[model samples]
Target: MFFFGTFRHSLDDKSRCTLPNCFRDDLGKVVYATKGLDNCLNIYPEETFKVLCEKNAKLNELDSAQRRYQRMFFQTSFKYEVDKSGRITLSKNHLQIAGINKDIVIVGNNDHIEIWDKDIFEKIDALQNEEFESNAQLIAQTYKE
Candidate 1:
């Protein structure tokens, strides 16, 4: 499923946050949350996470770099079920890693969702806007047939 949008949300005192309604159906009941690039947390559907794990498993386990990558990727991951109220409780570790407190921004990154601290997300968003025109032009030029 392709996720596309930027939504603002707040974590309750218990660290529970509601999933955006647009993503709720595609996310199903459970999702895997893990460390993401850019210091955000990634939320992936169960099947998608399994596919990712399978791909990672194909890498040579004998290689030290690969092993370390695998360890970091899997060890920090957690599976969460979206409650009846469409909420998920983020782990304390995950929150701290992403520097998330009460305010958050959930962004759709094509195949997965990214959870970012609101302030951090704003900075990233500003940078994206600054580069958007050039990026779009590059994409258009590269894809032109």
Candidate 2:
């Protein structure tokens, strides 16, 4: 399922966060969390995570860069189960890696969800508008039928 929206959420004292209601069901009971390229955290549904793993598995093991990427990607990844209340507890390492504390901005990233530190997200978002047009043009050309 495609995720498409932004939501503001807060982690409780115990580091548990409630997933956005719109994204809850689609995320399934079990989900996977990993460090994103931009320092945010990426959450994917079980099936999606499996598909991602398969894709990563096909990367050239002989290439140093590819092997290093695989190591980094898998090393920081963790599995989480959505609680009955639709919440998932993030690990301390994950939080530190993303620079997240209490407040977070949850962003829908088409195939998955991203959790970002509130201030960091705002700073990144502010820059996005300026680059969107150029980026869109590039992407459109790549997808042109």
**Predictions in order: lDDT:** 0.93, 0.94
For candidate 1, write residues 61-113 as lDDT tens digits.
89999998888888889999999999999999999889998999999998899
Question: For this target, which candidate reaches the highest lDDT against the unseen true structure?
Answer: 2
**Worst lDDT 10-window in candidate 2:** 68-77
Model 2 deviation from native, Cα RMSD in Å: 1.1
What's the TM-score of each model vs. the native?
A: 0.93, 0.95
Record all residue pairs in model 1 with backbone atoms less than 3 Å apart, i.e. clashing: none
Question: Candidate 2 on 1-145: residue-level lDDT in tens?
Answer: 7999999989999999899999998999999999996779999999999999999989998999999899888998999999999999999999999999899999999999999999999999988988999999999999996
**Which stretches in model 2 have alpha-carbon errors above 4 Å?**
none
C-alpha RMSD (angstroms) for model 1: 1.4
What's model 1's lDDT at 121? 91
Q: Assess candidate 2 and give its lDDT.
A: 0.94
Q: Against the hidden true structure, what lDDT does model 1 obtain? A: 0.93
